[model samples]
Target: NSLAQFVFGFTESGRFGAARQTKNSLVINMSWGVGLGMVLDDKIFRGHNGFAGEFSHISLFANGRLCACGKQGCLETEASGWALTRMVKEKILEGSSSILVEKMNGKGEIQMEDVIKAANNDDVLAIELIAKIGDNIGRGIALLINIFNPELVILGGSLAQTGEYIRLPIKSAINKYSLSLVNNDTQLKLSQLGKRAGIIGACLLVRKRLLSLS
Candidate 1:
């Protein structure tokens, strides 16, 4: 699809410049959700059913929290924005110390933006929770590195806005778990495209599809 293709193209053009500059590169667009997109020989690869990049559903824990997909311990359960909110809510319910308590304003819901805001404000609990999410994401990325050995892993989505607070932990986890030889070469990057990625990708896809039909 163009969404996947545009993401791949944007990453290649913005970061790597030339496709040949890297051995192999993978573009992962993870926001409130997660997905893995690949650029192989400068082309987007969608497996047989066009469902190749369902990285979010990868089973990470055998008996972990339930996922919307009706599976337990899926990567999304631990690493996505929803997961972050869940963690924060759990902590708040436990009476953990956090600025989020007041930030909630009596609302019984926690949003990912609230977590990001709290983390940016140097809230220890927020920072720690985000770090945990990053670590879980890193573990998932490590598996991808082992399997694909791509030269790059680009992170996008609302959570990527937290920058180093999240990236650092993910890098640390990757370094600790991933094979040094393979992990060392892979670069983890935040999306420069930001929120525009989905729009850009969707537009690109439509244009391409129409062009193909012509």
Candidate 2:
């Protein structure tokens, strides 16, 4: 309880606060890569080896893209911001037409922010690419919801700034794949923390460990 209070206290006091009104919550940070954290029964649930929340490496595709984990088809292969950039670059290489192509102007590289900016400007390719990434993300999240059954799922990291662009597909996937009993009660929310959630979480984690040692 003290650990939970401490973690939450720091998080709440920081720039981004809790996105849900429950004791049980799962926070999935999706940026260049994916990371996951959970609070259960009002306490942080770090698995026995202190690596329980490694949600990014969960296999989502068999024979899918190779992940940095030296595995094929991990969730990070298709759902991370890096994944989106990869997808966009692939499309551009294949001679796909889009405003992004003009923006890139032979740069031969695309940042996630570039894609997001194009999407916001209503670039067709950018929107489609983001939607595809969102779909992949939603599929992974559907599994997590079924497994964890948490009351809330908070999405953080740079990609979450796209807001409804990503959220809609995620919701659609959850609605289609997750059981109504679980999906109905699980509220999906964008992290109020934006990109600072990870830093705040790290500080809280250190505090929790020091407290536990004492």
Local distance difference test, each candidate: 0.77, 0.76
| Tens digit of per-residue lDDT, candidate 2, span 171-191 | 898888888888898988888
Among all windows of ten consecutive residues in candidate 1, which has the lowest summed lDDT?
11-20
Give the TM-scores of the predictions, in the order they appear.
0.86, 0.85
lDDT of 2 at 119: 89
- Model 2: residues with Cα > 4 Å off, grouped in runs: 1-16, 103-105, 205-214
* Candidate 2 positional error at 19, Å: 4.3
TM match of model 2 to true structure: 0.85
Among the numbered candidates, top TM-score falls to 1
